[model samples]
Target: MAAKLIEGDPQRLGDYRLAGRLGAGRRGVVYEAYDSGGRRVAVKVPHGDSELWRPLAGEVAAIRAAAPYCTARVIDADCAGARPYVVSEYVAGPSLRGAGRTLAGPDLLHLAAALATALTALHEAGIVHRDLTPDNVLLGPDGPRVVGFGPVSPTETTLTWPRLAMSAPAYTAPEAFTGREYGPAADVFAWGAVVFHAATGREAFEGSSLGTVMHRVLSVDPDLGPIPQPLRALVADALAKDPERRPTARDLLRDLVHADATVRLGAPCLAPDCLTHASPAACLPAACLAPSGGEAPRWAQEWTAERLTAEEVLGRRVCLADALLVARAPLTLDFLLAAGGAMAARLRTPCDDPGLGTVAEDAYVTLDPADRPFAPAMFLRLADGRGGPRGTRGTEERIAEAFGPLVVRAGDLARLADPALPYAWPRLAGWIEADRDARARLARDRLFWLALTTLLTLALVVALATRGGPV
Candidate 1:
């Protein structure tokens, strides 16, 4: 419906005039409209249904509630009436569901870090996104922009929502399905699922049908085969059966930042001393730790204060003292989670280790990038363009498409499809889209890409390496 505009439509909502369609969601059909002041924005109007007003208002509220963190900004809203509307600053880049599937290694790592940072901000604000998934996250050129919130539970009113399947089976936290009133950890579970899907281009839970998937998510163990090491433990912990076993968004974010900076990422620091300080973590054999004063951001102070407690998802300790003391501020890794899924194993850009790095988090691997300096630049580029991955494989959609049919129950989706499930493609599409910026970052430095390409030529994952459009 978003692709085709109704002809001769007035295209005017309040002070805004519709120009084109940006996208669609549960509450309304968002159009690329201009507000009264002539600013380009996304104007969301109701789909002739009154039930959407409250949720739309709630989404606006969530955005405002978390705006101080700037996790993602929702400029304004008009949800006061029976049929509500919204006006938000447009995110011109791709969605996580679009790019994440294609981004690998460090590029994905950086992006995930940014997202984790944002998640920290959200948790600190006393708000929890019950619906955290790839489609809801926009991969803007600048960084990750999280969208849609305020509504605690997805309601069933229509079936055309943007990411229906993402909610029912693939992206939602387990508690959401079991009727448990969950908190921030629920979002974290979804976060891991998002990372899982992006890393392998497959679902963490697989089944031949909807019933089978429900059994898989509830009774079966998630297939963590595609997850890399440093991130494996983190992702597994996030998906813990007991919500208490999971890390609070804030804790998860902190651990992610420190862990990412300390080790090469595939390696986890088991030493209590190394794990405690935010300083570059020291694992035996090789050193992946960033400088002592790496993670120092304004947000770092928030996490740095002793008033807040930090704990790993699995009771494994993660501290941030030496690193903070060294920098006298937040470390660089603190900003990583702002990139989304940085703490997860979804990204594998540094491919220096050859064999997908190593097996265990503490297990070490060797990286001999033909051109070491060029690697970081490649990651930054991929981060920028990794909004939507217009990848070469067309058959992959079958996997994504399978979700709508996979876990759907009769009344469950029919009632919640509007506010819950909604439409198809966009949700998963956003996370799976290739983050071109990440690739372009490498591409612009053609020499660097050339060097990395040479190295990738020997990699088994090379089969998974394919170019996407320049979206």
Candidate 2:
């Protein structure tokens, strides 16, 4: 992947000389570099202002924490100058996505387990990867090594803003998008997405639209494609909408390790070198051990906005908006569909409240796209105005017809939906309204303080002049 450094590429990042371009993304440019001692490493230089470089300290700490478990150790970092840079051990391998080779069977299991182990280390240190996708994983000669983990601002939206460039909407956890309390469980959810992609040779819930991707992550089950047996079930559990229900990274590592052990114990090596004893690497073929050693066919691809197709550009925009909008729209027609179907079944038998229908009816208008924020702008472009009725009545009726006759259990209903389904809409509205109010209050407070300070300063000056002191 080495190429001559072109114009705009920094000649030196700290003491390392930028030799060739490793990769470039929205956030930063990665360079294949060598240090003063002639040791090879990767240097990532942020492209924007001081605000973008502020998160580097936290990112560096997280990377250092993850070093013990398949993460490249941070070698150096400098934030003193106008441009900030971080140098980490350069892993010479293709990313899991660009490996250009199929990863399934035992190889896939190994990679998944390694990633889980890495995440376990990271989570134990109280750092969420936030953005863990196939592109971030480097399959080195040893195993899968996670590289990118610095300065991804959850609120940054600009593509030129290097602080938050690694946004993968499909791989993002449901709680993350909803602005709910997300923790290590969110990283586990992304782990499932990565495993799905590796097993199926395709994105788990990829679509032509960001709305489509969001809906799938939030409401629809992932198309696991032809993933076989136990692994499919494991992936499904990881993709569970309820964060608590998803297994811990340690739990995943153990399960994968156990599964791998079971297979090894059951099969005896047929190698003629020795029947006495053998390690997994000693017996397995070199091809099986190095599943990621391959070449990308499109090696000469350049990073440019003009090269991006319309669909690709839109997807990027959606990702950027998703990252920026902390308080998203409260309701979606899809959310109403699932909740309405459950509500209808409950109405059949009398509960404490017979007027539940009225309550549901009252909340319907909020489901309209006009009330929503982040996603509506992007989705509206895809929908024509002449679709149908604007309110939730029409949508509820459609959902009721689809699920009312069937025996739908609450567990089944909540599986594809977020566990905070009941409070999501109301809480979403509350967060958005509260944020607006807080901003207004802060603005007023600033002005009031400014006026008070000015008055106090003038009074002091008058008093000093009357006392014959230097004014």
Candidate 3:
């Protein structure tokens, strides 16, 4: 519910007239306003001369590009004005946190799916909702609508002090605490926490102090006893300490929708008479061949045979012998690798190419001689400038035709990788270990202070008794 606007509040901004205050935060106040057409909208007016207005404008622009199914549509914005403001479709309902009851059965499922769908749209548009919490989700009449979409500094302190001094510690990912850049994976972690709270009516991680909450988030596995099956497993995966192990938003949506087995990848036809000249594999989509089967599609089997034959032939070539073939976009390669079912060995390239003596033991060799540092190796180049695969089919179809076995071998690996992590973990481990030690030291210091305070209180009582009442 919106509170009546008070003194000093702007009644009008641009073409909209503010009616009441929706909420207020460090960034600014959100007012319930109406546009020239009298359409109710939520207007966020940043505090005077805030640097955040620029970034907020950028965020609004990015969000405007996203699908509006489960998100509040951005109506308008004016960052260049004396009083910059952003107007969005006003979601008139209580936040998920204010729902006041634990969601169960279909309600819980609906919430999860809706949130995932919203995230998929944002991620597809290359936007990460860094502040996805229960409070940020509005339980609209239509359904759950994810609202706030922008960056929130993890280190920012709140007036709430010991309880929530650090920004949403329970919902924040482990990587965020280690000073690693927050990505879409962090939002997934928050999604897990949010869903867990909705299901159980308690935070996935809870602590009396910020330090304790941070420790739990960084090192402790969340208890999934209260959450029901399937969702429990999904939430657990989302809350994995390692961000790389978490599923993409699209993967989450697919699982929730139970569409993995039925969804088919369609390939575009090169020509009307493509069937006469090229093999059926060149025209038909592989997913259509074995839509519901446990067995790999015929095209996938053929692609596997082709890939093996190519690899064997390439093995004879001295320069290509040890290199892993990319064959598709770097995102496809990452999806296959992270799926953890790919047959190809992981390679690293500290140097430009293996041809140079400075190359690491496991390095990539691309068909394109242009030196690309740490670029994934390509095998059967999907794109050959003519009216063949690249011209006729999409990347997914081409990848399926070329690395079909690898794709079918790792079924879920076909999903495009958005918000992909860099292929390196040596430093990640060190960062986690160091953060753990620092947290441990902080815990010890807190305990020492607690013990010291208790001892001092005891000593004071004893001395006061010995010295009599008034001393």
TM-score of each: 0.55, 0.52, 0.53
lDDT of each: 0.50, 0.57, 0.59
Compose the digit string of candidate 3's lDDT tens values, residues 263-350.
1122332232322222433444454445554675654574445643323423444122111221222222223222211111111112
Better of 1 and 2 by TM-score: 1
Best by lDDT: 3
Candidate 3's TM-score? 0.53
User: Is 1 or 3 the stronger prediction by lDDT?
Assistant: 3
lDDT tens digits by residue: candidate 2, 297-355 = 13112212134432343345322111111112222222222222221122121123211
lDDT of 2 at 237: 91
Q: Which stretches of candidate 1 lie over 4 Å from their true place?
A: 7-10, 46-62, 67-70, 150-167, 263-471
Question: In candidate 3, residue 384 scores what lDDT?
Answer: 15
lDDT of 1 by residue, 1-471 (tens): 123346644456676656556566553466665554445566666555555455555545765666333245557776666546666776555566665455556555555565566666677666776556677777665556666554332443222222444444666566656666567787788777767766776778777876677667667778776667667777888877677788766665666555555554344444534443444222332443434667644434443454232322112223233232223223333333332332332322222211111111111112233333232332222234322112322322222222232222332111111111111223222322444455666677998878788887656354555443232
Clash counts for the predictions, in order: 80, 1, 5
In candidate 2 the C-alpha lDDT for residue 17 amounts to: 65
lDDT of 2 at 363: 45
The superposed Cα distance between candidate 1 and the true structure at residue 337, in angstroms, equals 7.3
